[model samples]
Target: MFRVLHRAGQSHDLTYVVVVIGVVVVHVVLVLVLVIVVVVVAVIGGVEVVLVLVIVVVVVVVVVVVVVVAAEAASAPVPIVLTTVTFLFGERTWR
Candidate 1:
C-alpha cells in the first residue's frame, strides 16, 4: 500500500510539471502571435491609407472633367438648339 501511494505521488508531481510547462509555452506563443498581427496591421494600414487617397484623387479628377465637358456642351449653340428641339418633339431634329 505504501509503495502504491508513493507511485501515485510521483505521477501527480510529473503531471504538475507538464501542466506548468504547457501553460508557459502557450503564453509565449500567444504573445508572439499578437506581436506579428500588430506589425502586419501597422504596415498594411499605411498602404490602405495611401490607396484610399489615390482613389479619392482620381474620382475628383473625373468629376471635374465631366462637369467641365457638360458645361461646355450646354453653352454651345448647336446643343442648345438640339436640346430645345428634343424637348418639344420628344426626339432631336438634326439639320
Candidate 2:
C-alpha cells in the first residue's frame, strides 16, 4: 500500500493517493476490530453463554465507534485519518 502511494505520489495523482489512503484506513480499522473479536472468542474457549454476551457487546461498541468516527470525519477527515494512523502506527501525526 505504501508502495502504491509512493508511485501515485511520483505520478502526481494526489487525489487517488488520498482516496486509497482513506479506504485503507477504514479497512485496517475494521480488520483490526474483527481480529480482536476473533482472538477474544478463541481465548474464551466457546463458552456458549459468555460468547453470546461478548459478541453482543462487541457489536454495539463497534457500531457506536463507527458512527462517531463517521460523523467527525465527515466534517474534517484529516484528523480522523491521523487518529487512525496514529492508532495503527504508534506514531502520532496529529498533536
Candidate 3:
C-alpha cells in the first residue's frame, strides 16, 4: 500500500519503513551472532583435541625414555655408589 500523505495528516508509510528496517536489522544481527558462536565452539573443540593428542604423545615419549634409560643402566659394567651430602636447609646429611 503506497499511499501518499494528505495535507492535514502525516504519512503512515514512514512507520512501516522504519518497522521493516528494524526487523531486518534485528534478524541479521541474530544470525551473525549465531554463526560466531558456532565458530567459536568448533575452534575450542579443535584445540581440546590437539591438547589431548599432545598429552598422549608426551606420555608415550616419557615411557619410552624411561624404558631405554633403565635398559642402559642395567647393561652398564661400572658399579654405582651413594655418597652422603649435606643440604643448606637441613643439618642431617644424606645417607
Q: Using lDDT, give the best candidate's number.
A: 2
Tens digits of lDDT, candidate 2, 1-95: 56556766898977657766775776778678767776787777666745775678678867976886787678753445554565456453444
Task: Output the TM-score of candidate 3.
Answer: 0.36
Off by over 4 Å in 2: 1-46, 76-78, 91-95
TM-score of each: 0.36, 0.40, 0.36
* Each model's lDDT: 0.50, 0.66, 0.43
lDDT of 1 by residue, 1-95 (tens): 23323543687755434333443454467567555655676577876765665566557656864675477457653343333334345442544
Cα lDDT over the full model 3: 0.43
Clashing pairs in 3: none
| Per-residue lDDT of candidate 3, residues 1-95 (tens digit) | 11211311354344434433443454467567555655675577776765665566557656864675466447533211100011122223333
What lDDT score goes with residue 22 in model 1? Answer: 43
Clash count per candidate: 0, 0, 0
Best by TM-score: 2
